[model samples]
Target: MTDTCVVVPTIREWECVRDYVANAREYGHLDRLFFVLVTEDFCDTDGMREMLEEEGVEGRVFDGEAREQWYEARGIEEYGDLIPAASHAETSFGLLYLWAHERFDFGVFIDDDTLPHDTDYFGQHYRNLEHTGETLAVESDERWVNVLYRNVEEHGLYPRGYPYSAMDEEVGETTEQVDHVVASQGLWTNVPDLDAVRILMDGDLQGQAQTRTTREDYGEDFVAATGNYLTVCSMNLAFRREVVPAFYQLPMDDNPWDVGRFDDIWSGVFLKRAADLMGHHVYNGTPLCEHNKAPRSTFGDLNNEVPALELNEHVWHIADDAGEDAESYAEAFGAMADALVADDTDYINDEFLTFVGEHMNRWLNCLDAIETGEPLAEPTPADD
Candidate 1:
């Protein structure tokens, strides 16, 4: 049996955690799985720990203080500082800690609001990551695969961060099979991961009745062709431990810019670029999760997404150009960061780009610190 851990970052109450534990116990491989819950300062960590203990769930809840201690003990305290206290991207810290400490064979990520479908959720993810059998190899002429098309019955719907310009491009599919699956992205049954604009357009603004979108069965799982990229949602995602180095979810909150909500999408961009260069495969499908999305102001989400819209159009292309000459995931990531820093774009200013690029390199340094078991050297101040 492969060692697996589920990483969840949540600000919700204990009942949310309790439901996930129950779902895992009932539909997942509970015995083979461990849970790493990263909670906000407001959460009751003690109560959460007690609930896990009473439920016989092998898990630990990390509040802000505990996470700081974990990073400090590993000598990667600087990396911990990069993650904001109340952001969704804080899950990146949990993932790094798992890689550097627990060393699980596989890591699965899910949102606190999602529940596993009645099927064998963890088993399917494990099988996909393990590449148990042959699966379809697909590519798009547009260079981007809208995975939403495969998972949902609805037409004209795209996942968050999908390039608006590429929606009309032609798709070329292949029946070839590949065995190098390193990542598996499970689909969601209810309240699929759509952008705020889409949510508003579909619901209140358009005056349409709200509805849930369920996963449509697409016989067999498929992997992206060597050159194609897929939009990866951190929720319902599973990847082998080897990819963790290149899989740092980009931080969106607490930056000196207006951008937010592109963390996982951009992370996927870099991961896919690196995976393509390294001869690994990313699988899409199976192990559907029921996403009972929590209520939030759609207008606020729209505001957060506004600045990212333009960045989304160009970042994937930038990653592609930067990664073409790279030989490894780390190298590809480094190249991408350099490209971002060098880019002259009208939408994203130089100051924000420099900040983002600096953090990208900082993430790499964190991984190096873990591998070398040494503290990261202080970054030199830039000449003004």
Candidate 2:
């Protein structure tokens, strides 16, 4: 009757995972959605499971040591010393273990750090998945950025382009929203049984995301599977179990993985390459888990960020471009924008160097405006 499942991976995410499961159950589709948590630290498995059961939400936790074996099988023992603590890749690998060895039609991958502030978030994904595609997620207002394409390699953006395929040749007409949807926070559907997951497990990182994708054999419909850029914050992402492959441990024997930051980015790159071969679309539609405690990314800087972000949760009626319209805020995204446009670098490492936290909140704000005409605008001083 139901086609979607909720997959939460845990390492030290006991608290977050507990909150995520409870929120998912409150959404009304808990019966249809399977909740599975993979723990990297097996010792915590029983505690995490007990915690879930105590909360009236049932879940399954896979072996933590087996996860390590998955890595050894792939030759990643070298990075035993370097994998960053609490990195997306590390958390992701735990989730990947669940995906590779599990059975499901569609799976939603949500990070353990977030606690859904609203229950409707998951219900939306349930509806979107029924429509079409392997992935669906929130827009994050990624389309608004003019320089999005430039940061593809740097951000690991993906076969991810905005405005959603301007031309639709199926009937010689383009659609309004988008066909290439990347499901985060839950949609995760439309995987062709064994398509996205079957052959990709039990290999190195490249093998799980790269080699397996390119090396696989699919009908002309898909050559490989790709993931979302901003949608894949390692916090909330949902996809048909098959639309994406289960992740493999970093091949430490071949090369040590820094796992410092960019693991999820690299995951996007691998999936994008696969999707590109098949000529499929990737997008965001379903709402994922958001950090109510945090506003922006710790690794981001604010530039061209509408400036009035802190004043209001929504923005509308912006009546100026640059110049005095832009106040003197040193941490503004404009600095990053300048580096992106003026310099010869794909990433904006402006000499002005400012700290950008909550990197996607700015984009999420833009998306909220489009979804609801809520007033997200900041008024300019008429006297000035």
Candidate 3:
């Protein structure tokens, strides 16, 4: 059975769950829709779960505490602990941890604030996966799939983690250099993921503005994105289950960086490089989503810009260098982790390595448990 899983990590964004799932159903039936809400000690988990149940949406709601419990039970408390104490960070790890255990053939990740604008949003992602597989099998090594992200309400507005510096307008690279991409991202409307600095600097559109790149103009086509301009967000992206490993959110650090910042930037960079190494391609697709973002804290967003500027300049190089081995995606992932650790910058630290090691080990164990019908090792319960 083909199971499609969508994972949404939220802290207080509970209000939108019902509507998000409602729009999801318009595209296809989901096998499991996970809403992992992070709270202190898994507090109010039942309340939250009941709230979603009241909405009549079919999904499981687990808390941060339940995640810790799962990790301890699996004898990987250290690995789980490596996930930062921040709720946003915990939320990211919780989603990946669930993927490590769950069974599914396809997966989609969307931020709670993002809503599907088209009925075919889910189907388009799945179709791209199919196209990606066929392209890789029969087409060529250079072909890969990456969804497009078209931002609404603003022409130059891009997502927070987007490598706007690498836009084709500046690089002038043709599609031939970067062809056949499978994993792509869709764009958003209503406060598209642009930087605060740019927004303030431009001082344009206090409320709303017309967005660029509609499906009616471009149609449902998987256009080849220039190699220089590839970036994606958890806001609205999908991938095959096999590529889930590549989408693992990088561990958040205790440094000065703001919470929930730069994680997707790292993911986008790493996934693109991993796909390239595996002979898969990535793109920016045409399916659009409306991102009704909440009001922003200007100060926090400004602080986030510091790391964004540094990383946007160099992260891709790290990914590009790591993928030089041309190893399989799984092998390249470990290699990439090792490279990230070797760099040992404040962003990529000892804790991130531990997280990576545990994740890699768990992935193998997960496969073993499924193949041999043997359960994974767990911590011994204390005597009552």
TM-score against truth, every candidate: 0.90, 0.46, 0.74
Of the candidates shown, which would achieve the greatest TM-score relative to the real structure?
1
Error of 3 at 116 (Å): 2.1
Give candidate 3 regions above 4 Å deviation.
Answer: 26-28, 31-44, 55-58, 132-154, 163-168, 171-182, 204-220, 223-229, 256-260, 344-384
CA deviation > 4 Å runs, candidate 1:
13-28, 132-134, 151-155, 205-211, 217-219, 374-384
lDDT of 3 by residue, 1-384 (tens): 336556666665656666666765665544345444545543555666777677655455555556677665555565565456653444445445445545555566677676777567766666666553222111112222222222222355544555554443322223333334556566665555665555555463442223333443323344333333355666777666566556666545454344346666676777777776665666454467777776656556666555446555555665567747746656666666666556655553234444553554454444334344434643322210
Looking at model 2, which ten-residue stretch has the lowest summed lDDT? 311-320
**lDDT pick, better of 1 and 3:** 1
Which lDDT tens digits does candidate 2 get at residues 1-384?
A: 444556665565557765665666676666666566655553576676677677765455544455445445444444233222333344444433333344455666675545665547666655554445433221223222111222223422222111222111111112333344333322111111111121123222221122211102211111112222221334555555544331221111112211122344324433333333333444442453443222233222122121212211111011011112322221122322233233332222221111111221232232223234432222211110
Q: State each model's C-alpha RMSD to the native.
A: 5.5, 20.9, 6.1
Better of 1 and 3 by TM-score: 1
Which residue pairs does candidate 1 place in steric collision?
Answer: none
What are the lDDT scores of the predictions, listed in order?
Answer: 0.76, 0.36, 0.54
> Backbone collision count in every prediction?
0, 36, 29
Candidate 2's C-alpha runs over 4 A off are 1-5, 40-43, 66-87, 91-102, 132-182, 185-231, 246-259, 285-288, 292-384
